[model samples]
Target: MEDIVFLYRLVPGHVHHSYGLHCALLAGVPDEIIKRAEVVLDAVSKNNCVERLCNENISAQDDEYKNAMEKLLTFDIDSGDLNLFFEEIFSSS
Candidate 1:
């Protein structure tokens, strides 16, 4: 859970919220992590979903969010695989 929060802070804002949600889901995190992820997801959805925006813009953002999620899911953290995840994230940044 703390790792999730650290990862969330490590990523850029565009992908930060979704990163934590995806990581928590992929890692099969505990209830507390799931709850936190949901809050972040809800806030992000609300902020991104603008009523007057063009469809293309919305679609692009959705695509980017999905891509970010997929990227996070690529790392297998099933057995508490934090080192590789952290290494990948830090190296990439």
Candidate 2:
């Protein structure tokens, strides 16, 4: 959460917001279901984030993919239904 909040604060665009969110989810979540979620985020995962080293460029505009992610993020999952739930959004067990 700390890293995510910090990254999110540093970046002021939709693409970076999603990237920060991906870092939070991937870094914090358990291994079992990681691949499941990865399949969903695969569209946004590209270039290995080493743009300078690899000199690899990928477009940041994919509203269709982001819209799909928005559907995933915006859904209310019975509060603690999330295995990788955001702590700030959760109050109790």
Candidate 3:
């Protein structure tokens, strides 16, 4: 993951967010569940998600968010979706 991020930086004109999206997509996350999935990742381990986000200074584009999202949804699909966190995330901020 760190390697992926470093490469993203070395390459100019690349939006770092793309890396997140790539990750999400490869992890098999669905587009709809992204926000909740992000919230979950934000709450739990700050390792993969935050490190990449901060190191790259990237806020996800739809593509990158989706990428990170796919990873988020892979196993925790049911829990990661809006049906579970919609109210909490959107409602709070």
Q: Name the best candidate (by lDDT).
A: 1
Candidate 1 pairs with clashing backbones: none
Better of 1 and 3 by lDDT: 1
Off by over 4 Å in 2: 1-5, 10-13, 16-28, 44-93
Give a tens-digit lDDT track for model 1, residues 1-93.
344344324554465324655666777788865875576567666775423334786787777667657768886667657777666555653
Instruction: Give each model's whole-structure lDDT.
Output: 0.62, 0.48, 0.52
lDDT agreement of model 2 with the native? 0.48
Better of 1 and 2 by lDDT: 1
Please state every model's RMSD to the true fold in angstroms.
17.0, 15.7, 16.9
Q: TM-scores of all models?
A: 0.26, 0.25, 0.21
Q: TM-score of model 2 relative to the true fold?
A: 0.25
Put down candidate 3 lDDT per residue, 1-93, tens digits, no spaces.
344442433655523243564577667889655765666556444545433333242443554666555544563654566554545433433
Rank order (by TM-score, best first): 1, 2, 3
Question: Rank by lDDT, descending?
Answer: 1, 3, 2
Task: Give a tens-digit lDDT track for model 2, residues 1-93.
Answer: 254243334455445325534564657876534655555455455544322212223223344446546656886887645655444333321
